[model samples]
Target: MEGSLCDLPAGLRGDYAAAGPDFTLPQDWAAYTPADHATWRTLYARQAALLPPHAATAYREGLARLDFTAGVPDFAEATARLRAATGWSLVAVPGLLPDDAFFAHLAARRFPVTRWIRRPEELDYIVEPDIFHDAFGHVPLLTQPDFARFLEAYGQLGDAAARIGALKPLARLYWHMVEFGLIREGGAIRAYGAGILSSSAETLHATTGAAARRLRFDLRRVLRSDYFIDHLQPTYFVIDDFSKLFGAMRDLPAQLAAARDAAPIPPGAAAPGDQPIP
Candidate 1:
C-alpha cells in the first residue's frame, strides 16, 4: 500500500469501531456494491498479468496460493487462508493508523489493511490506500517465511525508533524499501514493494523507466535516505535476497540511534557510501 500514510479519522461517518482497544473495525463487506468488486477485479487482472515478469519471486509465489478468479475477496476469507499458511491475518482499519498502532499490529503478525475500496475513478491513483492496495499489493509477500519475519522485525524496530525520536529516518526506510523498493532477479530488476506492485504505471517505470536510479541495498544508507510520496519514486533500493532484509537488520536499533541526527540523502542522488547500480 503506497500511500498507507494518511490517517483516516477513527470515528467518522463510515468508520466501524470494532471490539478492541487497538481500534480495529469490521470490514463491513456487505456494504460493498457490485461496482466495488468489479473495480477490484479490473485492478487485479491488469496488475496480475504484468507482475509475473516484474514482481519478486516471494510475491509471485505468495500470490499463487490465493485465488482471485472471483472478484473481490472477503477479508474473513483472506484472513483464514493467510493465517493457516503463515500465522498472519488481516484486520480492517479505517485507514492508516498512528505509527504505534501500525507497529503493534505488525508486531503481533496482524496486518491492518484498509477496508474500503477505491472508486472506479480512483483506479489509477489515490492519495490514500484502499483495500485493493493493502490486500493486493502487500498481503502476498506475507506468505513468504523470511519476508514475514522481516516485517515483524520491522514493526519491533519501528516501535523502538519511535521512542528515541528516530522514527523519521525509520519512515524513510519504510518508504523506499517496503513501499517502493526494487529487487534484482536473474540479473534483472524486479519490484517487491507493494506500491509498485499495485501501480501498473510505476511497475513499468521501476523496471524500465527513464531516470530511475536503482541502487544496491545498503542498510546504513537506506535508513538515512529520503523519498517522495506524491509521485513516482525517483529512486529505489534493490536487495539481493528477501532474507537479506532480516540479516542486515540485526544492528538496526543501534544504527538508528547513532544516525538519528544524520542529514538525509535526498532522493535520486547518490550518497557518499552508495554503490550506484549501473
Candidate 2:
C-alpha cells in the first residue's frame, strides 16, 4: 500500500481504460458486483461509527446532506446532492491522476474520484486510491461552502505552481492539510482530513495513538514538511479555524514563493519557527 501509481497492489488487475486529459471517466455503476457493494457497506459502517467522537461536525452534517450509505453511491445521485448544496460535483477518474489534471478538475469545482473500488483484501491498505477512499473519504467535506472554496482555490493555485516547478511545496500543503490535518472544536481537537476520514483504523490511531505528534497548524511549516505516503502520519497539524485555511489561499502564490527557499522537514520534525501544539 506504499508508493505511487506504479506501486499497485500485487497480483490484482482491472482493465480500466486510459483516462482523458481531464482524467474523467464513467462510474459504470451497474458494473459493481455484490462483493464491491459489500466492501463499501463494511468500510462505511465501521468508519461511520468511529467518526462522531473524532471527526469534525461538518463531515457528519455533510453525510446527512448526501449520504453514501446503503451501498456504493451512484455518481449521478451523489453528485446531484453535492451540486445542489455547494456547486461541487463528483466526477469519475481511472485512478491516481497527474497533478495538473487533478488541479484542473478542482478548479472547475469537480472532484475526480477513482471509478473502481478496492479489493476486499485491500480494505485497509491500497497503493492507489480506490472509490471508497476518494468518495467516502473526500466528497462529504466538499459539500461545505467555505471548505469547497478552499479546495477550488488550491486547485487554481496548484495549476499555476505546476507550471513554474513549484508544485512540490503545494503538494506538501495538500498532503498535510487536506489529507492528514486536524482542527479544533469546543477546545477539542478533531480529524477533518480525508486520509483520516475513510480509514477506521487510522482514525482511531490519529486521534488517540500514543506515538502521534499533534502540532499547531502553520502554513510555511506545512509546505516545508515531508510525509510518509505508506504509513500512519507521524504528525498532525491542527488548525483553530477553517477560515484560517481559506484566508491563506488569498496569498498562496506569494506563500509558495517564500516557502520555495526553505528545505522540507520530514514528518515528526518541526522547524524552529513552528508554534508546536501542546
Candidate 3:
C-alpha cells in the first residue's frame, strides 16, 4: 500500500496489533480481513504471470516453498519456510530500518520485514515497502542457496563498509546487483533480483529494452556507478553466473578492508573506462 494499515482502504482495517521490536508491526497477522486476502491474491496473480518468463528458477521455487499463493503469509509460517531454506527467518519491523539495525539483522541471518499491506489505489506505487514489497518482492529469492548466503555476507560487508564510510558505494553495488541484477542462462537474460521480480511493469523493460545499458558484472566499476532510486534503473549489471557473487564474499572481509583504505569517489562519477551506456 501507499502507507500503513491506518491508511488502508475502507474494507481492509482490522484488529491488528504490533509485531516487531520497533512495535510497528501488526500483532494480528492471522486476522487479516477479506479485503487484505483479496489484495494479496490480486498482487500475487499479477506478479506470477509476469515473473515466470523473467525471474530466476530459485525465486520460482522459493515462492512455492513459502506457499506464497495462499495469501498474505503469516510471518511465523513464512519464517518457518525461510529458516528451513537458508538458516534465515523473517522478523517483523515497522518500515525503513536504521542502516545499522538492517545490517545487523542481515549479519545474523534474520530479515526484518514491514508487516503492513498497501492500499488498493496504491497497488503499483508506494514510497515504502509494504507486505507485498517485503514478502512478495524479497522473501522468495532467499530460498536459493547462493543468494541466501550472499545476503548474509552482504550484511556483514555493510557493517564493515559503514565503519569505513563507504556505505554509499557499497549500497550502489547492492542496488545494481542484488536489487536489480539480471543473469544469463542458456543464451537468454533472466531476472534474479527481487526489485524486478515483484515489479510487474519494469520486468519487461529490464529484459528487452534498449534504453538501459546491460554491463558485465565488475565489482569496482559497479561501486562507482550512480543510480536513481526513485525511478527505473538506467543501467543493469548481468551476471554470467550467480555463484560469483557468493565467491566474492569468501574474501570479502579483506576486500572491504582494502576498499576502506582506498580513496572515496564522488557520486555519479564512473571509474576510468567504466562508462555505462547512456
Question: Worst lDDT window (10 residues) for model 1?
Answer: 1-10
Clashes of 3: 4
Candidate 1 collision pairs: none
CA deviation > 4 Å runs, candidate 3:
1-27, 251-278
Root-mean-square deviation of every model: 3.4, 3.6, 5.7
Off by over 4 Å in 2: 1-18
Q: What TM-score fits each model?
A: 0.92, 0.92, 0.84
Per-residue lDDT tens digits of candidate 2, residues 173-266? 9988998878889987789888998887779878778888888887878888899999989988998877788888887888787677777797
Model 1 Cα lDDT, one tens digit per residue, 1-278: 11222454444423544424576878778888999889988999999999878999888988877775467778788888888888999888877677878888888999998878888998999888888888889998888887888888888776679779998878877887888878888898999899999999999989888788888998888888888877888888999888888787797887897668888888777777667676
lDDT of 3 by residue, 1-278 (tens): 01244433444232234433333354368767889988989999998998767887777878888888878888888888788878898877766665666777888888877767888887787767777888887888888888888888888777678767777777776778877888877777788777777677668878877776677777766765667776777678888776888886776555554555566544344466653432
Deviation in angstroms for 222 in model 3? 1.4
Candidate 3 lDDT (Cα, 0 to 1): 0.73
